[model samples]
Target: MVTDFIELGFAMESGREIPQFSRFEGPVQVITRGPVPAQALADLDRLLARLRGEAGIEINRAAPAATLVNASFNASDVPQNLIAVEFLPRRQMQAVVPNAACFVVPNVSNWSDFVANRRSSAIDWTRVVSRTQAAVFVPSDTTPQEIRDCLHEEIGQALGPLNDLFRLADSVFNDDNFQTTLTGFDMLLLRVWYAPELRSGMSKAEVQARLPTLFNRLNPSGRRPSNVDPGPTPRVWQQAVEQALASDGGLVERRAGATRALSLARAQGWRDNRLALSLMLNARLAPRDQGEAALDALLAAAELYRRAPGGEVHAAHIDMHLAVQALATGQAEMVLDLTARALPAAERSENAAFIASLGFLRAEALSLIGRTNEAERLRVDSFPAARYGFGTEAAARARMDEIARIGTAAQRLARL
Candidate 1:
C-alpha cells in the first residue's frame, strides 16, 4: 500500500486526470514591473536565494523591467526560460482576478498577454509541457507580510505544485493559509519537482511509478508513520466553506454555511486539521450574542489542532483569538499563558504580524498584573515588527491602541 505521504505527493502533483509536470527548463530569470515597494523587492530577492539554496533550483532576480521575448523552449537554450513577475497596484490586479491576493500563470510573459489570453484555453496549465515564460502578479498596496507571503506561495506555484491541498498541514501549498512561509516539506517537494529524473508532461501513472524511489532517495526520513489520508474533499463541503468565508455575505447565511461544513466534517469522521479548521470557521461566524459558544468552539478546535501534526501554527492562531477574549474578561494570567504558548510558534513561522499581535497582548496582560516596566519594554519591542506586519505606522499605532483599549475595558470591569 502506498503511504499517505506518497498519496499526498500525487495529490499535489496532479489535480486533473493526466499529470501535468511543468517547470523552468533552465536557469529562471525573474523580472519585475509596476511601482513595486522597496520591502517587496528585498523580500523577493531573499525568496529567490532561498529557492536556490534550499530547493537546488537555479533562480535569480533579473534587471528591473528586463526585456521579455517570445521564444520556443529548447533544453539546450537557457535564455528562453525567462519568467517575468510584475507587481501591480491592487486595482489593476483585482481587475484581472477579483480580490485575488496574487497568482501565477504559465505561457504568458506580461500583463497584457495575460489579459488577452485570460479567457483562452491556450494559457491552461494542464496543456503546458515545459514552462518557458510565465507571469506572477502581486499587489503592492497590501501589508508587507502579505507581500512576502504572496512571493513565497506564488513563486513556488510558478515553479512547482499547481494545486493547494487542505490536508497538507505543514506547507504554504495548503489553502488553509495557516503556514505563511515555505516549510521543509515544501522545499523537499520542490527538490523532487526539479529532479532530473522527472521531466515535463509525464503521465500520472508514469510519475506515480517514479515517486516511491524518488522520495526514498531524496527524503529518507519520510518513511515514518504518515497521517491517514482523509480522502477527497466533498464538493458540498467545499461550497459550504466558500460560502462561510466569503468576504461579502449575510451573517446569518454565513453562519449557517459554517454550521453545515462543521456537520459535514463530523459526518466524515475527520479528526485532522481540516476538522479543526471547520470548527474555527464556525466559531468566527458565531453570532454576537453567542460569545460563550464561540469561545467553546475555539477551545475545542485548539485542542484538536494541538494533537495534529504540524499544527503549532494553527494552534497559535487560535491562541491569539483566545488571548483577546481572555484580556477582555480580565483573565490576565490566562492571556499571558496563551500568548506565551503562541509567540514561539509565530516567530518560528516568520509571521511578524502574529508576533507583534501576541507581543501587544502579552504587554497588556503584564500590565494588568502590575508589571508596568516589563509591559512598557514589551510594548516598545513590538513596534518594529508591528510596522512591518501592519504595513504603516498609522496601522501599527491603531493596533497598539486597540490592545490598550481592551486592557482598559478589562480594568473597568474588574473594578466593578
Candidate 2:
C-alpha cells in the first residue's frame, strides 16, 4: 500500500475524491531523538491523547517502542506494524532520515515565519506515503507549542490522507496549519480507511470508487460539510494581524506595522476586521484587561463592534479569541456568553477553521462549567480544528485544562 502511494508523488485533491491510506493497520510510536527534555515527552503525551481520544478516528495510543538517536529503518528488522515518529532537531532530520523518502515537519517562529518557510522541494515529501517512518523536526529553543504544531501536522500526514490541500480549510492537513489539532474532516478520512468494509492494500481507484457511498451511508444527514471550498479567504488585515501580535522585528517595528494595518483597515471601511485587529493588538501589546482604564477601552471596543457595520460572522471571529482569553482569566461563565455570541454566526457560515476554533472554546467553557460529557463530546468533535487553532500541540487547551482541573471555577476566578 505504501509503495503504491510513493509512486503517486504529491497527493492531489479536487472536489470528488479525498486522499487516504490504502490500508490502515499501523501502531504509531512516538520516540524522542537526542537530548529531548522531559517536558517534550509530556507534550507528546498530550498530542497522543488528542490523536487517540479526540481524532474522531480510533487511532490507538501505544507506548513509544524505543528511543533511537541515530536510527534508520532497516525495513527488515523493524516490525512492519511499527511506524515511528522521531522527534529531533531540524538540522538533525536529514541525518536521521537520510536520503530515504520522509516527511519533514515545517517549523515557524511565528505566522510570518510560517509564510516565509512554506513548501521547499529540498525537504523530502515522499515519506508521508512511505510504508513506514517519518520525522518531526524541532528547531532549537522553540516553545513546546511550536514543536507540537510540527507534530500535529507531520505526524498526521504520516498517518494517512497524505495530501495537503488548499481547499481543505478545517483539517490540519491543510497547508495553513491554522487548525493544529486533527479536525472532523481528518477523522472522516481515517474512518473511511479503517472501516470494517475498507481493507488494507486497496488502490486509490478502489477507495475513491467506494468512499462516496460509504460516506453517505455513515452520515446520511451530511454532518460533514462538503470540501469543495473553504468559504472566502481570510482578509489581508487578518493575515497581517499576525505581524503585530507576534514578537517579530523590534517592538517599534511591530507596532508600526500593526498601526498601519489597522489604519488601512479603517480607511478601507473594514470595520469588523479592524475591530478584531485592534483587540488583538490590545491583547498582545496593551492588554487592557490588566487595568480598569484598559478594561474600559476593551468594553468600548466591543461596544463599537456592536454598532459597527461589521457582520455577525466577522464579529464572531473576534468573539472566538475573546472567549479564549476569558477562559484563560477564569471567566468560564463569561466564556459561555462570549462563545454564544459566535455560535449563531458560526452555524450560518462555512468557515471550517472558524467553526472548529469556536467549538473548542465552547468545549473549554463547558468543561469549566462542569458539563464534562458535553465538553468531551465537543472536544472530540473539534478534532483537527482544536489543534489547528490552538496549535496541534494544544498549548492553550492544555493550560485551560490544567486550570479547570486544579481548582473550582470560583477558585480559578479568584486566582486571576
Backbone N/Cα/C clashes per model: 0, 10
Q: For model 2, what is the error of residue 171's alpha carbon versus the real structure, in angstroms, after optimal superposition?
A: 2.0
- Among all candidates shown, the one with the greatest lDDT: 1
Candidate 2 is scored at a TM of 0.46
lDDT of 2 by residue, 1-416 (tens): 12222222225322223333343355554555555655556656776676666444444434446666555434354544333444445454445445322253322212222224445532233322334433445543445445556666666665555555432334555443345455555655555555566655555666556666777766566645543322322345544555665544677667666665656556655434255445445544553455554455455455655553323444566577666668767677888898788886665443445666666667767777678899879867865544543444565467446534533554456657
TM-score of each predicted structure versus truth: 0.92, 0.46
lDDT of 2: 0.52
Model 2 residue runs over 4 Å out of place are 1-26, 53-65, 70-75, 90-130, 199-201, 223-416
- Which residue pairs in candidate 2 collide? 178-388, 179-388, 180-387, 180-388, 181-384, 181-387, 181-388, 182-383, 182-384, 183-384
How many backbone clashes can be found in candidate 1?
0
Candidate 1 lDDT by residue in tens digits, 249-282: 8998888889999999999998877788899999
Q: Which prediction has the highest TM-score against the true structure? A: 1
